[model samples]
Target: MFGRGFTLSLSVFFTLFIVFLYGPTVSILVLSFQGPNGGLTFPMRGFSTFWFESLFDGVGVIDIWGAFGRSIRLGLVVMVLTVILSLMAGLAFRKRFLISSFLFYATISSLIVPSIVISLGVALEFRIIDDAIKVFGDNMGIQWVVDDFRTTMGLFSSGLGAQLTWTLPFGLLIMFAVFNRFDPSYEEAARDLGAGPWQTFREAVLPIIAPSLIGVALFGFTLSYDELARSSQAIGGLNTLPLELRGLTTTVTDPTIYALGTLTTAVSFLAISIFLILFALLRRRTNKPSSSKRSTL
Candidate 1:
């Protein structure tokens, strides 16, 4: 809105901010790979693969890996659940009113609730359910499976649901952003061509919004994976990476904790890079044929 000088000033400001934030992160990453570790020397006491080797040498690396895997699975489930719930809520409230406002505030409140408060409520509720199981066991022949597969699933789903309190709001916003720009004419055309509602959605609407859906899924999954407070509170029996990392940092003061931190950051960076590459490829694939057809026309 101003001049090139304004843009240059903004760029410089952001550059300084990024450097300030990432400088320590870069230093730790470099230090994590250093072989000889006394404290935090700069020049490194001769290069060696000690740090990387130590990752699996003594520490419970297998447990860390298991936690990482569980986090990934939980993240995927949370993302899917968030997307599904958001899609339904968004579509249902395309025309907003009092109900829409109420739903919006209700969904957002879950995000605002303190993690400790939510955790207390969840724990108390489960305890009551356990008590009920005992009472039922004494009265009836059926003993409730509080620790069974079904119960575990319920806990997992509920934990993810607690995450969805905020996840759904963001997801819904994304869906609305996508649908706002969508051209209903395409759907109408599909119908005019004798396509059914589901067929129109599959063939026309989906293709138009697939990128947004994928973007939302990735964003929500990343958020869920990195979340610690909610995961700690809601996940009764499961341990996620963030929780594991915290426990290690607190209980075990090993230098390998730095290695774990470096690994986590590296994995996140790699995932982001892959997503960017895939997005660029998708855009190229979508554009090339259209450009070629336009040239021929």
Candidate 2:
């Protein structure tokens, strides 16, 4: 229906948009293979895996592996929590509750609020918790609490909460969209067949929503994995990969940093690939019986 000129213009626009989006990443990926003596700038000095090798050797004084582990663990925790809590919230909101509107807006308010602000708020809140613990320890004569207790901010505590503030809203919004378009007849048929609520959901509702849940999980894991601003002040005592990467930017002056960036980007792509694979599997499984039934008939 469109003219050839319009189509050509649209294709050119899309090509430029793709280049604009990924050009830096592609440059970093290419630069990461620079030789051992290579500088950060161009003029590719004899391409080699030296920088990638250097990443394993060490990147300055930073704990690269430890930070990676922390990010992975935190991302997994955030993923599980986001999926569960979002599913709960989505289900709860399916029926009108007294404070549903208020709660939803409150949950979504995190998206509108600045991430650094949330980080600072969580840090301050945890400092208050630490103070309370200290006071309690003094009053109760708990020597361990008094002498050994440090701040309450850590990966699973304040860090998890902050990342959730970012991931959960996205999860909830996804779930809301999924459930909104959901066919109720499936659940009704399950109920008619004498299935309990849990059984109904497990057999009918859950299967249909499985693909979307995989999407939510992808968002949860990736968002938490790459999270920096909200994780900055809240993740105490140790750092996640992104935080470490940010720190390395100031200290490390080589293609090793670019190698790190490439590795992390590879990790993100791997996560996305895994999630997409799972989504496809779930979709195929969900459709299998229908296809078989139609073929048999």
Candidate 3:
């Protein structure tokens, strides 16, 4: 049994933790709406939408908006690939073999290594590969890596291989958890009912795992979308939202950056809310009809 003093202490800790986490976000949102030229001062003056307006007008519709679009696209690609690779690696891991050992080690390595270190190593590797290709001039044995449009989509050939190397491990761990809990009986039952392994997985396993899969995908998407170091190194100074925000801090000391931050935070929050609501609705729909309705039938 827990003591009263312990409970009080725990409650205080949680209250402080929550406040620490959310206080900056609340402050940023408030500052975003504060008048443009005044800067963030106490005893707030009148509210204005000038920052939001300036975001569209001053930055031009192309650069900021285009970078936003590219970031979203990169995030989507990373999520899809991460999920696919994770699912494959996870399922493979259920088997006990040397292959599983290699994957296990790979996943752990990704988690252990620092992101900046990984980025630097990858960039160097790519540079070496580029040099080889240039020397051979069409007879190269193999190209190491290159930063190009494909990298924009989080592709390895485009020099995001190292970034994926980092993200895929976390993703694989998530999928491993999902697959670990999956009972073999489900597969057996499906096979007994004339379903092949692939068919069984498609109908029996995937549907059940859909929600967890989506949650993992969401995490991967957000992780890659907000990633700064990998994007900065892998793409060779190309700007994602985070990179842009950091660059903007140097010259554009306006409320617009705060506004952009607020916007990003709001969009992420709204998205998570919508996903939760939709998940609940879908779950309710999948439940069997009430006993009263069944009896009436």
Candidate 4:
């Protein structure tokens, strides 16, 4: 339906868009293999894994491995919580009750708010909690709480909450889409087959929505792993990988930073690959012919 000129223009535009999107990542991946004596700029100074080696050997007092570990742990936790809470919320919203619309809007409002504001709010809330604890401890003569107990803005607490504010909306939205198109006859058939509520979900609803849950898990983990703004103030005393990477950009001017970037990108790709593979497998299983039907055939 289009002319040759339009087709050529569209192709050129897509090509340029792809290049613009991935050009910097490609540059970083190429430069990450810089030799031991190489600089960060152009003119590829030999090719080796020396910069990657430098990353392991300790890059100027910063805890790269520690930050990576924190990011991974937090991402896994966020993934699990997002899946559970979003699934529950999706199921709850399936039935219209009082305040359902209000709750949904409240959940989605987090997405429109600024991420740094969420970070600061979580931080301030935790500070208030700390103050409250100190007062209570002093009044109750609890020395441990007054003296030894510190802030509660660690990885699994305020950090998790802040990241959830970013991830849960996406998860809930995915679940909402998944359930919206869901066939209710499957549940009816399962009920006719004498299945209970849990069994009906397990054999009918769950299998159909398994792939979508995997997608939600992927979104959760990836978002949490790469989160910087919401995690900045909430992750007290320690840093996640993204935060460390930002700090490294200012202090470390070598290609080792590029190596770090390449490594983290590889990790993100690995997580995405794993989730996609699982999704495909679940889809195949769900679509497979039943053994009883095959035998009858």
* Count of backbone clashes, every candidate in sequence: 0, 0, 0, 0
Report the poorest 10 consecutive residues by lDDT, candidate 4.
288-297
The TM-score of candidate 4 is 0.96
After TM-score superposition, the amount by which residue 286's alpha carbon in candidate 3 deviates from its true location, in angstroms, is 5.6
Candidates 1 and 4 compared: the better one by lDDT is: 4
lDDT of each: 0.71, 0.91, 0.71, 0.92
Model 3 clashing residue pairs (backbone): none
lDDT per residue (tens digit) for residues 13-54 in model 4: 999999999998999899999877889988788999999988
Task: For candidate 2, write residues 10-94 as lDDT tens digits.
Answer: 9999999999999988999999999877899897999899999999988878889999999999999999999999998898999
Candidate 3 accuracy as lDDT: 0.71
Give the alpha carbon lDDT tens digit for every residue of 118-164 in model 3.
77777777777666655564454334433222222233344357557
Best-to-worst order by TM-score is 4, 2, 3, 1
Estimate the TM-score of every prediction: 0.83, 0.95, 0.85, 0.96
- Flag regions of model 4 displaced more than 4 Å: 292-297
Once superposed on the true structure, which residue ranges of model 2 sit more than 4 Å away at CA? 1-3, 290-297
Point to the candidate with the largest TM-score: 4
